[model samples]
Target: MMESQQEPKVTIPPLIPLEYSNRMMLKTILECGDDQIGLFGKTVVVGGWVKSSKEVKREPVAAALKPPTAAEAFPPSPGRKELSCVEVVQSRIPFFKKIIRVFGVSSDSYPGVREKFEPVPKPPPPPPSKFFLQISDASSISSLMVVIDSAVVPVSAGHVLPTGTCILAQGVLEKSSSHGKQTIELKVEKILHIGTVEPDTYPLSRKRLPLDSLRDYPHIRPRTTTVASITRICDTLDFAAHTFLHNHGFLHVQVPIITTIDSEGFSEKFQVTTSKKWGLGSGSDADVRHETVKAEQHIEARDKSKLGTGVKPEVKEDFFGRQSYLSVSGRLHLESYACALGNVYSFGPRFRAEKTGSIKQVAEMWVVEVEIAFSQLEDSMKCAEDCFKFLCKWILDHCPHDMKFVTKRIDKTIVHRLEYMMSISYERISYREAVDILRKVTDKTFETKLRWGVPLTAEHLSYLADDHYKRPVIIYDYPKAVKPFYVRLNDDGKTVAAFDMVVPKMGTVITGSQSEERLDMLSARMKEFDLSRDQYEWYQDLRKHGTVKHSGFRLGFDLMVLLMTTGLTDVRDVVPFPRTHGKANN
Candidate 1:
């Protein structure tokens, strides 16, 4: 084997001093200067989108004078302007002193020096002044007053930095004593406008844009404060979920997005086909299928008229030779892993083809599905409960800045909701108990009547979790007839070991159930549900050999975000693209 050569390392020189170019985040700026004032002298670089900008006048520095005569200095003449200036300069003491460089000043001169007062000619007015820009990088936002006095580049003909411009600024950290408070600020020196947005034509504004309008411009909406904050919350949730799962000894797995078998075994799936009529060619699979169908229809008409015997023609094959679809859930694939891995989970996008018009519906969404082998229904529920609580507490501790923005703008009760989710124990009850609670509520009206064997509606779930309990509620043991075929049938044979975790404002954020491990029972359920046995033969094989009782659940990742952000009533608002019944804009 040949030996590999080492590559040389490349380094970029700093435009600002190395000490200040530590690239400190805005959130930590206070901590850097709070205790030790030494950090205040260093220069730092900050990058963010400009929130606002305003022009301000600049004042010239005060001129220095020569040291006063012995008689003038000893008496400390209050009437003498130079004497008063010296006293004011002396008050600053050892902490701070102005450095004045006169034409003939010596190095050992006294602190206050006076030369013949020659009125220096004032420089011409600075080419259109710069303004203070309030900037935020989404994580931690701070204001930067970038004056266009020195080498600061001019943005345009007359204006300074415009709002919404993304710039990287190098500046000195200084404490402001102007407004009686010693607040920190960045005196920007060199600015690199990484991105410039024309304020008038920009889709995102400093002011809150209407949520509907924002949905129309999905590509650019992330730049807005509302969407940006929600995106951060989602990112944090992803981290929290993975951290919680990994910490609890759950192996993360990736499942296929396209498959032949429907996890739910329902017709509500986005069909994937390679058949094309007008696009690919004339003699394509689609054309072949169409001609065969036409010929069969003609033959059938002739046979109906007693002219000939008719037979249906076989359909031609497509690319896959059989029908395929985008996965509606990863639960079935996750089940295969759980049977061997003991504990496993998968997090990714899932698709549905329902023409749902409700605010909660979307064609594409994210699901965090977990499966654990040798675990019963109760064990699965406990793990799910702990995971949910852990995520709630994790976001509160890690994403304080974004959560504060959400609480103030989106929902005032968001923090309280998260706290309640974390602090209180969730209420757990069987399907029979849940129906009884709904039946006793005679005072309130329900759009759909509450009863046994019927699938639970959103309103019913919300009322139980939000209004009735005022906290999260996990309802288990759903009627087998209403749930999917994979759910384990109870001993009584009436209900399945299924559960749903519903919370205030958003119902049914999570759904899980114990999977059937008995081959015969699972096959019987598949036949009962009219699902093809041939398609699920692999699924049944898991139960055929050494099948251990396993349970799992899926949390709708988008719904979780929507619940945390109260302002987003529609599920479309939380996702990157609102892929609904009609709209599919790029």
Candidate 2:
């Protein structure tokens, strides 16, 4: 079920007594451990893939004449002679059972002082011939041994229960007194095999798989512990993002994925087109140029015609009648809703036609773009800080178990990093001040020289956040020439009111700025970019009517998850179905 995207159909027991009905309570391995003490004499069910299995032969013994003491039990007295007792030889088979406990001990005097239970015995375990299963339910894993007779589940000598076979078992919880120690374990009565895998053919067996190897089988990789744990954390991140916005009175607005405008003015976007039946497929640049020139000549000829008649000139119809592309950002469209709704946010897929395959870049990724009316650059920075902090705290409180896996295997300092980020306020620095700090640093050589007007690279960003600041740093008031034309120009006319939030390890998780609200300023800026005037008339109208100072920032939702997860360095590994240059796999 974890390997597939479809939700599993769950069956729950009706309200009834544990002993009265045949139905068994479905419990997770973690839940089973919590109720270990109280679950005695109760019938419950658990499902997981079998880790190991073995067959055991049972021998019959006659009625005991007297009871045996503790020392004379299974690990019989070292030097004691064997008892001569009659044995009724009958054929029977036994299964394995072992105990697992999930709990902690505490004292009332010191409320915070706590202790864990003693570790399970490491010496001799149950006989090797019994069935054993290391079961995982994507939350916690446990070792489950079948303690049933062969009569319950008939098996031949040649029959084998291979690893990675999914199964559901109905059992009663009980304490086990085996060769030397006592432990709690399940005693299975009936079992059903949901699916079986051939040990020789299964790609993901019990062996530890490398992260890169898992990428080759994305469809089934979620069934593995690492991927499954990451998927769970991603779900929490998605919920936390929306919850933070909703709490701040931000309305969730759905924006179009297909748009006619390149919102960021980057010109890097995926073109959307229907089946090319009208000479639209596979054309060279020269051919496209020739066709464009022909279309222009036809329009010019029609315009030159003296239309003394009342009928308007006929126009050719085509798909959309204009070049449209997948949206690079929803910030432009979001402004429309923001102006009417006060504050609005869009969370969905955004595409880019970039060919680079850097760890931080992906062709298709999700972004959380926000827009706020009647606000300025400062307000955008404050809102970004508040929303980001909320998400960090939410994950720490909600997904501790999954986080433990990340902290243990990936970056050991992830928890501390997040805690520090949540504990202190984000420091703000002007772009010029940031450059000055970099210039003063003589210790490390920067690939890109420190300069006032140049755009900051990842190296510069990491140094500012991780090496110098030792925390998230917000650098604002970037040079106007290097920033988007829509960013509000300062009174000095040299720098624009733009900001970027950079954190240690992950550079620039959020980027935004106050937008130009003056009609003349916006028009002049658009012209500087060489964009067609008619294409932006709608955007310009907002300023002509009643535009107020507005600002907002966009956060790469998957990139944020990568930062929170610590050692996960690549955005491709974090996002499901990664779309990269020359690669788009389902």
Query: Number of clashing residue pairs in every model?
Result: 8, 1
| lDDT tens digits by residue: candidate 2, 211-263 | 77776777867667777778878889899999999988999999999888877
**Count: clashes, candidate 2:** 1
Write model 1 residue lDDT over 1-586, tens digit each, in one string.
9989987543322233236545545555543334424445567777777766666655655555555554444455566546555455455543332332344544347534343222344454454454666676665523444333443654552333566777787777666534633366677777755577776887765477788888989998876778877888889899999999999899999999998987876559997875432123349788777877776676667557663544432223566767788999899999888888889999999999999897887999998999998889999899989988898899899878777878888788888888888999999988899899999998898999877889888888888987899888999999988889899999998999999998878888888999998888898899998988888888888888788899999988888888764447888889988798888987
- Name the top lDDT candidate: 1
The collision pairs in model 1 are 20-43, 65-113, 65-114, 66-113, 66-114, 66-115, 67-113, 67-114
TM-score of each: 0.76, 0.74
Q: What's model 1's lDDT at 204? A: 68
